[model samples]
Target: MNDEKFLKGKVALITGAGSGFGREMAKCFASKGADLVINDINMEGLEETRDIILKDHKVEIFLAKADISNSEEVNNMAKKVSEKFDNVFLLVNNAGIDSGLYASLKSKEDSYDKVMAVNVKGAWNVTKAFFRQMKRQRQFEPIRGKIINIASCAGTENGINPFFGVYSASKATLIAFTKLWALELGPSDITVNAISPGVFLTPLYKNDPKVIRLLLEARGVKLPIDKIGEAKWVADIALFLASPTANYITGQNLILDGGMTISINKL
Candidate 1:
């Protein structure tokens, strides 16, 4: 029954904090008393996120504009974070991009590269930069800190999708990373976990009506959860894993799809 603000005094760094799960997670963590360091390419969106969070929590917040795919920028961001925050207890590698460049497109490789650059490489750069710092420092109990990676169930279950090869591959890689990093970082007590979100009504889904419709149709009649998931759902999961309660959890990917992934296939 330890309840004196789970995230109080902890510092959390989240990429893609300008929109979707990243933005919502920022607010959730702040509400629980965690200081924030958020990164995103959209300055306006980032500002909006900051404004919304400032309304309730009185915690330190740092907003940085940078593309996660840029190694230099990510490294620099990590350095700057180290300068400002004394205790960096959580890292959420949530900055990702989904290019609708299906395999049918002529320049599909180009699209795949772009998606991989952001979805996969970006995650790698940010994690490597931040984890290096965590590995050096000695702080909080059970686990020094936590890293929650946002992956997709598409990687594991729906590899047969018509044109989502690249996206699927990237997610598969993330899943593998979760397993590998858990083993590598277990010694230092730094837990690494992944969340494979099935269908969510975040900004990503908001962008394309056709895609949304397709997901709805694919789900069939009487959807599992009336509507798609909100960013808050993913955020809550991320916050839980980062909290002290999930200290014993690591190397596992929790699927959050409103029960979408567990359904029996019917065609």
Candidate 2:
């Protein structure tokens, strides 16, 4: 609703923008006057997200239903984005999925591949595609670009999470990629960072029945956040990281766990 233009005249490409953090980030960026290219595999969800943002924010938005795991589709999405925006100032690799609870002994190859494809490989493809634009900008423009990746606290801690081992590992891989890319892009004035969210109640989580059971059984109860983290929190952080305000920061992971990770010892 805030029409103040921090990102005026900028362009952003966000993956997995159909729901949760991605959807919220799209709205936030639109509110700040940024044109958006939102990608997701969920066509219905993508349409709803597009409609919502289009209502209040008149910024140009393009939505595509592409699975990030498919390299060809991903590359095509990147091409479409580039054609629409010419150059992207903000690239957010935020599409991911939960593989449910699988024990180490019960982990299947399909499970590993599915999780890795979206969480790790998907991030890589998007980053690589956008980096080409960043590199190109390095020669002509100011090259002040940002890459914000979404990670999770599970990457750093292992507790009673069921079937989340693969998911955690995928997030850890993304964090690692963020660090390495930050190093590679910093000299060009491009910033790369990651965000690790705790328990945020979103459609992405609520839709997974098995994940809800795992949470209830593992912790026995939910924390007292009243409501889980809103998608807006993640969006706000993304805006900060992409803005000139965070120009000096790069290769850092901001854990937005809402005290959950901090209270692990007491629990």
Candidate 3:
């Protein structure tokens, strides 16, 4: 556990913060004394998340409701955030959607369109909207900032499953973007990375226990850690990346699948 107030006065922007990983990351960062700019399509959930955090942590919470899939909305959101905070030092692209279970080969065009719009283009939109702002912050600090893309193990063989082909491809593209953007942004001292997490009982899974069991079995029979993941597990890794300790780490995809990918690679 990190000591208190290590991230005091820092500003973090997290998208898809209504629940699950986004909410958990918000809480974790708040606990460390980071003011937040949280976004979600669900205003009620976002408000609730803000209230939950304010009760315990004295951190500023700025809520923005916008669809990340739309570039215009994301640009407007960037402008809105600029009014509250000078710059967003930490950005977590946590908003993504999965296109239900089906053979991706026969999946409808609409399905792919929606998934890519949110999972791939949505991330691109948010990053593009704030790239210059993050880069400009370099004038004050050697390290401009950190951009954490919430990719998935599904993008790799580690967590790939029978019906997640579309989501996997989208996440793979996200990983590629991470590498390319990191290379471009390196000159400005801005770090870009991806965290590929495995099976977790997020709201998507909690909504359907059967789906969780199916996903777990599809990923693997057993993981080295022999347990399911929680949002905090990924949040802890995000916390490390957001901190100055990760100043030298960029353009990398950190896997947090409890060795599930390694086990899969063995077979």
Question: Whose lDDT is greatest here?
Answer: 3
In terms of lDDT, the poorest run of 10 residues in model 2 is 155-164
Tens-place lDDT digits, model 1, residues 1-267: 156578887889999999989999999898888999999999999999999999887998999888899999988888888888868889898988775635434436778788889988999898888887777558687778789999987666643243455777788888888888899998988999999887677778775656766865764623467566677889989988988888999999998876655552443
Listed per candidate, the RMSD to the true structure in angstroms reads 2.3, 2.9, 1.8
Candidate 1 residue runs with Cα over 4 Å from true position: 1-4, 104-107, 158-160, 207-211, 218-222, 264-266
Best candidate according to TM-score: 3
- Per residue, candidate 3 scores C-alpha lDDT tens digits across 1-267 of 345676676789999999899999999999999999999999998999999999999989999999999999999999999887886788999999988877678789999999999999999999998888888885448688789999998887556655677988899889999999999999999999999998786996765656776766765556789778888999999999987778889999999988877787676
lDDT of 2 by residue, 29-138 (tens): 99899998889999888899999999998888888779898889988988887777766788999999977767645778988899999999999988887787876665
Which residue window of length 10 is worst by lDDT in model 3? Answer: 156-165
Pull out the clashing pairs in model 3: none
After superposing candidate 2, which stretches have Cα over 4 Å from the reference? Answer: 1-3, 138-143, 157-163, 207-217, 220-227
Assess every candidate by TM-score. Answer: 0.91, 0.89, 0.94
> 163 in model 3: Cα distance from truth in Å?
2.8
